[model samples]
Target: MSQRPRLHAPTKRLDIQGLRAVAVVLVVAEHVFAQPIGGFVGVDVFFVISGFLITSLLLAEHSRTGRISLTAFYWRRVRRLMPAAVVVIAATLAAVLLLVPQRAPQSLADAGWSLVFLANWRFADQQTDYFAADGPVSPFQHFWSLSVEEQFYLVVPVLLVTTLAIGRRSSPRVVALSTLSVGVVASAVLAPIQSTADPETAYFSTPVRAWELGVGSLLAFGTAIWGRLPAWFGTSLSWTGLVGILVSAVCITGQGAFPFPAAAAPVISAAMVLVGGVRGPTSGAAVLRAGPLVSIGNVSYSLYLWHFPLFIVIGAVDPSAVWWTVPLSIALAYVSYHLIERPCSVAPLAMWHRRERARFREALRPQRRSVQVSAIGLAAVTAVVLSLVATDRVRPIDIPTVPLAADATAAPTVGGEDRPALAALGKGIVDALSATSWPELDDGPGANLVGTQHPECGRLSPAPSAETCTFGSPTAERSLMLVGDSTAVHWIDAYLRLQDDGLLAGWRIVTRTAFGCPFIDASLGGQDATECASFRADTLDRITEVEPDVLVITNTFADTGVDGDGTAPGAAEWAAATQRYVVDVRESVGKVVLVSPPPAGQSVQNCYSVGGSPSACITETSSAWRSRLAALNAVAGDDATVVDSRPLFCTADTCPAFVERTIVKKDFVHLTSAYARKSAPALGELLRSRSVFEDTLVGH
Candidate 1:
């Protein structure tokens, strides 16, 4: 009798099917429930299972026939996976064009990638780009995992065949075992390193993920040795593994180190379950073989293909109806399981597998080299043509954003009578939610005109030579400094415009800004905390030495501990740190203007398209922010000019993406430089009105 259990026999093996069911449920719950389940490791479980099962099948075939048939393997894959996949892709594209025409382009691009089984690469590239990956999401995002699997399938067979050829005298099992061991080690080491450097890219990269599969393959190769363990041992291992998977799914989080340490919980647990099932049915096996789980597993492939699109479309159409998508997805999957999966893959595949020996000689037939060369040449030509025609990357004509009038050389100062009408800003919330299209803004410096401007004075890390970042009248003895984080940098354009309008003819302007470091006395916990700390130290010393006429503080209040003490935000923390900083700086400066961060709600980046209205992205102001602003004012203690900026970006109940003709924000939090420039008149008026700068000053 064969030492290894029959991996392919349905009657004998329902536990594997049950495991698949558990994996799919975990993945679906994470997506549909909006809770922290850490269920993404379910994909890792699938990878391990694939590695083990495919290895078992391949090695078994080689043992029985002395050779593997590439033709049969690839054809069987096509029959099993492609039919359902193609139908879903086509249907999703059609649905996007029909029901949600605004999203059709995203759907179409996703379809092309999915069709070629290269969705992972497409997503990886897009996800790495800050602009492309920010807000717009694809319905076919889940297809990336399928793409990784298909790529694995294409390469693994070739790897096995090549390794077998290299060690002709060695047993096929030995060659597979040795080759997979090295791959597991190499991939395990690379995954965490790459994940730390660029987590999104590492998430999709095949090389980084190969280790998960290698673990399963190693288990499969050793099945002969392990399959003979006692029933009691198998039972104990089975329960332990099931509990491990459940606990990991409940407790592990995706925000930390990831796939390496946390993923081991599920991967090792899955292997244990698989091994424990090799003998008589263990208690773990009995639980996994439950009817509902086995049934879900039977249709799991189709269910996965259907659920994501249904969830996305439903959420878009009516968020209230989104909960129903899962049930509908299962219904559709059941139908698809009956019609497409069984007819195309299951029923005919049994007959094909039975007759594979008869077609061995035909499978070995080689194709002509000329055909291969011609095909490759055509593909290269097509790629070149596509790249050139992708001029959509260039700025589109008729951009939704209004540019400055040609005659307007500088920001026109506006006050009481000249303030533009706020009631008639970007599209209304009602119109916005149902918008079909909007302008696609160019995503270069145009989008980041303010935040990315004046990097010498304002950046992510400490700049030793920032002493040289003085912008206006460098030789003037009287100085002004912009202080705080990237938010403080937002006002650089307004100040520059002030100098242009000859408001500060002789006073020099200096900047002490870093991306995340605010002029507050507290610790921050983010990737750039160290750099921010260094910059904070450098700027603190610089500010006291320069002792400028005005010290402007600007930073987002979203970070909690920034309340002054390194304590949680509450009744005590609200303005403690901020007020303390402002009070201390007052001793060495003329006046301090504490500019509050402008009101920003949800991102409007993906809320509309080229034909859509900006109004569709309208959102409500946060009461918490209003409370924070009030706390800052309460703590000002007569030393600072506390400017509430909500009037510039918000109405009583609504906030807008655009004000007048200028886009108010580039991303969710920061403003466009154009809006800052437009607001120059108001900002200068506010500073002058507050008497922060002496009425008769240098350059006045």
Candidate 2:
């Protein structure tokens, strides 16, 4: 619609503009629509383009003047980037304050960090939690890429200057390429390892991503050396490059290792497109220089800036209206380019050395000073708003004590109103923070509950055979084995304390837990499915070898391949798996206890940190768990003793997250150590009733 930006002179390399359009579109599509395309690689494409264009400009400047002007370069970067960034960030913070007060504190902090270009480090330190997916997307989260590029812009100039200064005998290109090559190789080497060890940290860290930008800088050297190539070669290279990029988008998903070899496809392919742009006016060049693509490319920067916040805001208002995100983003990008970007970036150049008289003499003069005052006012208002949000606090709900029933192991009744006492406790916690509470939670949603105290032993996925942790006496007359995943870890401390106190004098306990790997006969869904099957087999063998008098089976509903509904297609298969495990275990162990998992609640830790009352995170029932338990019952038959955990964790209609002033679950589903210890009496009593520990004398 609007004319292509004249500042960069489009005809010089119109294809780069087309690439920009493609990159921004990919990013927007992925974020807004959750497309299967690995559109995240779009940022890597931007990194390469930035490396090439900026290096090309710096080299050109050095060739002309024999040195780079650091002041001019930085000023231009700030001039081009900062104005629009400030506007978008301020607006995003303001929107958060108005719409999602619960996220206000976090959004304010993110904005503050983003302003200084430290968002990537901040997110890395936070570990960028996956559980927070249920919450509103942070509007400023996309600034991590901007922070990376800004960091690159800061370091590269100094690196080139130092390298050239030290290697006076060598050509500038040689020194530049050598410096960039070293960074590329070192970072490339580290990406895969770091990605495997800590993917969240690896994804956000500067060093891991530096190689991507370095690869682009190296491409500049190649371009300089080769100059223009044949037209036919350029066309073929462009087509192949496009195909490679498309393949990467189609093939790559966000599971497993990323940003190392997987990212190489898009990055190298983008490089190909850049290289092919050398000899212009070919068929491929014609496609890139087309009017529509050129227009989008011209405003690609604004598109990138506006899209994320717009998508977040749309979701905040009405999650179902995701369709509005793309069209509105394009419209806003166009408006932002014309109204803010063009005037701020270009007018300063026009007015750089003008006399005050010239402006006074003009008939239709630009109100540059008014615009400055308005911008400053907006910034000041944003600061004040964020300050209020950051400092806001809500009073925590007063806890009401309820005595733990000595017979808490009583069987829960089916489909009835919550017993009065449990209902009261749930109401108190839910009312802790009012619906209109300020500044949200400090910690984050339910991360604590997902973690275990003995993380070293219990948190492994497909844990090694030697990963077992033993409690109680090795020479005890009776043995008990607790096996499954993290869900079983919650009950461990309780059992260990019982053994420590000598309640069961002749009993030994062994626990084998692998997070996400319930001892099922069936394979799991993700990349580690086969490995989990192997773990299930290994754990079964361990159970048989120990030949424990009693075996406890516990796992979350997620193990059944049913996320919400228990009656999903895979329920029968899960039941069969449970039955298979049960049949195998019955042969070795005298008794088996199939522990029904606790009801899944909202992140209580997150709720507490967010100033939520107990009720906010507390729920009445874990329907999903109920469905899974039913599935387990259908196939488990009479071989195993079903230890229904409802009475221990819930009170008929309501499941309370807190009991006797202690937080029951650290996160959504895992029990805290203190809560586990408190539950030992009930669990110990239940086991005795089932004859699991009837032979042993129980004394304090």
Candidate 3:
């Protein structure tokens, strides 16, 4: 049998400090600029470096002592990682309490999960409908990465120790390397597939992250392989790898188009740099060894810990001051490193090293004690988190649930299938446009948009195209035409209530799904996009053909411009375009009623996913939304009667999803049919106050 070569400890530390600097910078850039498709690959780089360094130390200990002490390993990890983590978590909790009022319950629940390192599952469950325009932001969003690393730490040691138990006779290096290889192959193959299947969940899940760590482990075990590479080859690989890292950071944008196949570029590139640049006195290695870079690398952990909270706090306090806030955040991060982080890290390491020189075994026992204490501290944290969660569940927000009306409009009977009554009214409008048939509309359930389709005229044949899908109603004597985007369709339920009550005596409802078009002379993709052109032409034709009394137009006035909060579009451009749309609509129709949208709310699905209950998702009143609505209302003024529903939907303390047993909205903003009916009284009062009903009744 061949004898195993004695394990050789690395005389030089891999540029871990340099690697950390790269990781921290990439993460900071991702949050601040949100560019570079591979910006997220920085986490993968961290994972690989962690696995490599940790494995090397563990293997070295096992080789020297013939056994590994799980307690000592965990103690060192806890001392190195937990103190900063605990401080950050505690500080964040305090900030949330003081700075964030009317917090989303779902966010609170996510924070609870994060405290316990279960953020991966919490985020996974909530990411199902990840494409929803409105979703609550978890305050502890960064903790998911920590959870992945912690989970790896917990599992990898067990696997390593088990392998040792089975192979005291075989080479521990071979066994460790073999296991790492298997993990790397499995993770790389599974990660890409998962990214395609469910990108949001895959992004946060730990299993998918294992491959990054496995890559580092493999490198650590194959140090001899790297050592044997030619100097020229290593230098070329190192420079190329650094270039790839920079390219990934500069090119990748965080708008759901990243952290997938594109992420492979940065992950592979970072690995190559780590492997190739860790040897010799090459230029790449020399750069990493620079004084400033090495110092930043040493304090990288502190910088990472402080930067996020500083940004979040600054943004919360002065959202419009991004220019100053960005620089201020960096300043605060540097101060935190110098004041808190450097002192703490140096003190602990000094104490640990001093004790290691004398009474080594006795000193190691204290390390085990520290590990036990950390374990107890973790348990206490878990209990506190569970208690908060329990308390939250037991004493949820006191949202009043209103009962549904006994005389609520009945569902429409369609081919023996019961459908929302409002759907029938919309069908009537479609039928009238198709056949050009007029029928007497009664003030019955079918007259309501919720009840039946085209009560005046029987069912018409289906139209072949968008141009042909039209309907006319005898009640449409004044020719009221509804037009715009999906927001227009949302208002149909409310319009049906007016129609059922004999308010829209002469009107025709028309709709087109123009994905993101405002009803004006707008260009999309550097040209007059189909939706914009169609909207302008169609409105002109409809006005000429129908000669409408009142034109009701509504579109989400927030999505037609640049985004401010890194999630949704800003309101400045949207407000301007909406004002223009109102002007054009007013010119075509004698009267126009511009409805300001409801208070922006959290996604119902996201809340349920995270909090496990509908009541747990509360709508947030965004200042941006309020500002845009105000701007729109200011522009419309009396020329367009602005119908604001803020009072009807929200109270001073809370916004109840269901008002009087009727679901006010289907998602974040659109009203449900039952809820729309409830709005009839308030809407009628608004119309009367604005002389809208008077104009219709007097026929002037």
Candidate 4:
């Protein structure tokens, strides 16, 4: 009666479900076991499959009706995805609040973004920021891929429908193929370039990932040609596809540029299987359709949703409990599919096919369905709010107030025993964590110390002249120049305190520092490396011009691994640079004082924020310090004084992150204002005793 071909109901493809199972397994195995580097390619496999299936369905619908219903398409997506997603997010939020309260706010923010399908953009922003790079991983980080998929799906139907409607003279298949090809080619061309430049952002972005989906759409449109291929040829294609997936899973890792040529292995391979097995079974298809594989694939969406948060929670408790999490995730996924996904899928399907008013009245029942969906969504929101309220209070930690002794003024010299005051502070740190209640350290001071007091003086990308700030005895006749990166900036508080104490009476201290740059001439490449090198050259020239009475230089001097060559500087290279710098300084500056790097410790803000004990954050100065000392000591002539800061920050084998109520490093390596200022007396005494300024009067 109608001009449309009689379309058979879409049959369940056991092979596709098996592919889903394989993808989920690969993802779960990669995440849980930290092996089979290509396990992440499973995401690519899923993307391609989604593209093919969605395109095929849309094409089939258009052929039957001559037009596609946008309302039905979007409603189907909502019913199929939203219910399970909402429940899982709500549950994961509750779990995060209870177990990892430190990450509650971040998790809530991620969940909010995910609800609106913008999680990918959020992660992309975070990846671009160097400062936020080192923050702890969020359990919901995997939602980025879902966000990308959702955004792609949202645009594809609209694009295809518009093209089909506007170009009535062109064949629908041709129009769809042309539109999809542009997206595929454009994305393919851009992906490698973006991946090379900023792989972190490229990996999480939607535009860069569009090619994989577009390729799958191409396959769907080309089905007529592929359906006529020989069975033996199909078998070969299937085998090759399976092998490609397996090889990629084994070989690819997170270390290198990704989601381009590497991701192509999985995307193309999955496409081969889809195209090759269109009309008949191949060996790959047979394997995929196995009962065990199909069972897992049947609920792969829910499985993907549940696994990551479970991994994060279980990992926090026992990092090696992947055996438990993997199985638990599978079981929970099965339960979720039965309880939520299966029931939610029915309404969308039932309401999808209504040609007339009577049919719509009989079948749709739209108002009732809307009410039910809204109720479920509201319940999810209420549950999330409850979880947030339950964990609203910050866990309190007892910060021990270690009393400074009457003889706290004693400063330890090189190779001399550590001051008794430092020893007392170490004891207090150990005692503070010994209590039964493991509460978070109140980080009000440490949190505000970095930006509020120091501002952008040592941020990643800094303008040299703008970041340069004056410190001690500004109008004094003698000027002391502090030079290096953040490590140098850390000592500024101490310099200011010494000025107040008149330990630096005649000296006006000028701090010239950048974020991650050392004082050495050799390139230490990072995001800030070029600017740092430029700033370093300018600062050195300034030293020559100012010819300050004291040129005190210091830096972490640690190998920053983000180089253009992809290799960080070793000790030998560092030593060579140090020697070169010292030699240059001797020719220009009147007095060159090299301040040794402070004993490194874990991030005090992170440790305290996570409710970790002070003792847990303690670290020993590594043997690397000895090598650094050897290099600096080699270059030290009578004209240069090398001051070792280990005794000031550590006692023998142990280094505490906190001294009294003063938190040491705000992050991992930079010193906090309070601790830096408190250690000024020792630094002041060192500079006063060993330098040409030794004869200078000690202020009252």
Candidate 5:
């Protein structure tokens, strides 16, 4: 092996390096090899290690000299972390353009946040963002952990400096110990509390996660205890700690989420190993110090940085080769560590004033060009960001051209393969298999035209001007109210066109759609379910007030889970709730129309390219989603109008992304506005036949 990095100098512990190797490998198994080992806990292990190392280094500096030099501390941190991070982020940005064009905007923002050490904040918001449903995971997603550590590096050193200065007469060790103990306990307590409100906050919040690092710092502070311990006892404790880390990785699955009680397992386990190692090699140090393990540890940071992007890009370009990405990621990591990480971080912080007894003043060698180099790096990142802004129109999905004619609406029914729109869509999917580029949209993926009705459609607060949402005719005596999630909103363009074709010349259309808020009264274990439950309650109240002649409801239940768990299949609970909700809507407005979600299709960004089988992309059978639809219909019984949407969008078992010139869906599931509008006649005819227009007919 090429000479291992000598960065750790005298303080280097083989066990710690081994732990890094173990942590990184577990993470790779989860992300690249699809293993269930709580590989994510590897990050928790890293946090503990970082906390231990950084805090020890700072305290040693204070002990050697009367004061700590802030400039020296920050400069070392910049050298160790920033250069490699920037290179990886830049490479990730380039990868986004080549593999997944649509994710470019999100990736750039992710890169920007990563550079500033605020990536945790950006991702926490994204998890709860109702509108950001377009892309796959960001390539720079792993940077959130690096961001938190960077944040730790910034605050902890300053904290030590200030606390030591104020309590000059008091024991510095005691003051440090007390202050950090309080911080650790406070952060540990806050984690579960934050998780109940929002798991993302618990997962990514710096304050909530401080305890993991705090444990490591406390271990460093308690170094005096290690010297007094009997050798055999210390070795036993080390062995137990090694076992604990393994148990943590194997046991802690996503039963809830992270950064709480579950995270404690790895954090404590890491501390145990480090504390045990302070005594001697009697611990599991012999195994940890193995050549292959130490080599992996040496390049661990580079491995962590390279693995995620490789996993994502390989999946996009040639999914068949995804299994082999591990070797590729490790090879790249080795190269990056040698070429970039080692070279940039040649000046180790641990090499503190080898010759001088007068430490702080003598060691303060000011490098004049450091600030200028930082400024230049910042400018380069900013330039790339601005370039992305300039080319904003180079997107994954383009503004659709409405191709379906005005009279093209056809309500889908079983065995309606001959229907003009349905047949065209079937053929489009076939042609798309070998065709490159986006399909020229005929009807939708249309831009929102009736903006007032849909403004902030996914919030608890309904639009104040709900009355202005009326379409077709001014002073129309009858009305149709559209309600539910974005699934319902996607069909608005079609309904508006139904009126334009003079099917309902005097009907006023009202919209009560919320973004991710399905029309269920109870919260499922889905993302933002509690908030969505509130939105559902508010919209239900408005439904009674508006009392449209007929209320149209649509939402995708694939994300939903029953027993208040989004991960579990709702099955009975889902259908039961839909049945009850529809009956309640009927009580308020006397009519309920259920437009079940269409089958999931391959996203337009992939599978719609040349030389790919439509079957390869659109392989998920409708039965998976339709099971929920069937449950909903079973509960509704004869009381509500059940629109079997399969006939409209599918020809047999397959659902195509495109039909003729019409794009069936703008995203993974929602219909294109043009297709919605083009299919208006069919939907109108079905609704009319089901007595939806029984009361609101304009007999002029």
Candidate 6:
């Protein structure tokens, strides 16, 4: 590694190299262990360092010449930052195309955004939800940090020049302080809100992160306050700051949405290190400046750039190869720094410094107009190249659409012959129910049957009771009640097929869309209101009162065994309530059929936005789904036959999101109406085989 020069002049040399080492190590540890650890605050540290150093250099130049050179400053920044960034991005794009699954189009889009420094916005727009266990993990996830830093570098110089123009008579320190104060206050105020709104973006966005950098800038421009401090005090503070940074890395995990309120740890620690290092040689400062630490600092930027792509590619090729691949990745990063990065950076710095010296001695300079024109030309070229690369990265594939074959069956005898009788029965039930009796189902629109007024229900006007929805033809032999939560309602379209084909044997299909309420009389207190509990109780009572021949109850088992917000249930209360409901349903219903809930999967909304067809988004082979079903089925004893849909919906290796070109779901978990209807033949076969419905009468 190249040795860093000791500062002889009173220039603002505040251990930027040491800070870079801190930033890169945090980022690496976060990725390696898959922890949050406020690793992203490393980017905040970088931003601050950039703002401080760049502003100081510009101010120094302006003081010497009485004029600021925007063109020269930008040129130097581009040469320093862009070469490595462009190389890394280009390499990442190639790796993405080669390694990522064809099913994951989002990876391609994310790569494209990274190239253009818009990854923060792209991630924000997509539901980069941290709560989901199996959400999309784009290889280019780290690009958001790079994008924010690059963006800050782009705009800060412009802002500084404008401020200097307006306040020509003001002291440089005063202007710097004013700028830092405004940035700090704005960032602190916006940080919490953005963190709440979308933490992934808040973590990555330059505007929301300006305060961390502003803090550093203020410190850089402010005269040394720590020179008067006792030597022991400075050393203690430095060691404490270093320890804080290390402790945070070891402790924090990446389970929830990140860098929100959690960002204070790394930001504060970084500021401490800056203060400690600036004060004079402390134990911690000496350690940071030591040979091993300085070597890591020299290669840290290249390490950060290379590690993610290496992990991604290795995982893509063989997810199980992490043990060997991780070490190999570190070795490769070290090699890349030595061979590619160190040489490139040194060559440019040497050439630029030599040119600068020659220009200084000659006392000759280009016209302002000529310099501006050259800068514009260079910018235009860079923009064009970046645009072309982005376009190529995100080009869409042409997938041919295949039409599904329809089942060959005519309309049922019930539609023509039993219509009058069914209509009369529906009227009779509606007349029996009071207007205030039925509760409005508060499940989402997709799950609410009464709200949607689905065509199969045959009620053009709203009905007041659960019985009203299920009132059969007077001549009907049996009544089939579709009881339970939204999953049961999803299968209603399938049951409607049986009804359409006269397989229902004049039975009525009743739907009770209680969001996640299991048929058991259990109360999810604080989660569901008293009114909702009552509504569920009343609905269950009505189902038992009507006494349907076959009761189909289904629910999504609580996978986490806790509420959506991750709070644990009161064990004694939950157990008692659950057992009571199970007993009650078993006593009241004649024959209960439990439909195993669909697997917890990625949201189809993100899949669609990323250009995946609906068919590509379904989960068929998730272990989470398998484990959930196993537990739920065990709870359902002999009284109810638990139907495992995994075999019907999924293959051994993969699940067909669309079987026979019919989409299995509208979203992640719920079935689409058309797909639900197509599933009727299989469900009908299951019902007949199990003797839940008589084969001779239903006519499979």
Q: What is the C-alpha RMSD of each candidate to the true structure, in Å?
A: 11.0, 8.9, 14.7, 8.6, 9.3, 14.1
By lDDT, the candidates rank as 4, 2, 5, 1, 3, 6
In terms of lDDT, the poorest run of 10 residues in model 1 is 1-10
Top candidate on TM-score is: 5
Which candidate number would show the highest lDDT if scored against the true structure? 4
In angstroms, give how far residue 653 of model 3 lies from its true place. Answer: 30
> Which scores better on lDDT, 1 or 4?
4
lDDT by residue for model 3 (357-389), tens = 334344334345444554455456446544644
lDDT of 1 by residue, 1-700 (tens): 1122111244455788888898888888877885436777778888888888887888788778877888888887898899999999988887677545766766798889988889889889875421122244678988888888888888778877777767778675677678878888999999888776776777788888788888888887777666788878887887788788888888776644456655888999998988888775543468789999988988889999998887776454433345766766776776676556755663333343535433432332332243354345545643543353233223222222232455222112223443332223223322322333343433321223355456566666537375567777657767778888767777787787777774565778888877657777766643455677777777778877878877888887664333333334642364787777776666677778888776655444434334333444566556667677777777786778877665556544356565544566766677677777776666665666557776323232
Which lDDT values do the candidates have, in the order given?
Answer: 0.67, 0.68, 0.56, 0.69, 0.67, 0.55
Q: Tell me the lDDT of candidate 4.
A: 0.69
RMSD of 2: 8.9
Evaluated at residue 380, the lDDT of candidate 3 is 60
Over 1-700, each residue of candidate 2 has an lDDT whose tens digit, in order, gives: 2222243333578888888888888888888777735887788889888988988888778778888888989887887888888999988887766655666788899999899889989888988842134233468888898899889889998888787777767676677778778888999999998876777888887889888888778877676444467777877887788777777777776554667767889999988888888665443546777789888998899889988987776454433344666766676676667567765564344353445324422412344544455455545644653353334322233332342344333335322142443344344333432333433332233333334556655755536444347766677767778888778877788778778664555578888877767776665654346667677777888887888877888877653432222122355666677778888767787678788777776545333333323344445564456666777777666787777776566654356556655566766677777767766656666565556655322221
Candidate 3 lDDT (Cα, 0 to 1): 0.56
Minimal lDDT window, size 10, model 6: 407-416
Q: Predicted candidate 6: what Cα RMSD to the true structure? A: 14.1
lDDT of 5 by residue, 166-217 (tens): 7679787788778878888999889988866677666888998899998898
lDDT of 2: 0.68
Tens digits of per-residue lDDT, candidate 6, 91-131, equal 77776555344424666677778877888778777756433
Error of 3 at 162 (Å): 1.8
TM-score of each: 0.72, 0.67, 0.57, 0.71, 0.74, 0.61
CA deviation > 4 Å runs, candidate 2: 1-11, 129-138, 163-170, 224-227, 281-292, 310-328, 347-413, 416-482, 488-517, 520-552, 556-583, 590-700
Q: Model 6 has how many clashing residue pairs?
A: 3
Model 2: lDDT of residue 341 = 74
TM-score of 2: 0.67
Please provide the root mean square deviation of candidate 4 (C-alpha atoms, Å): 8.6
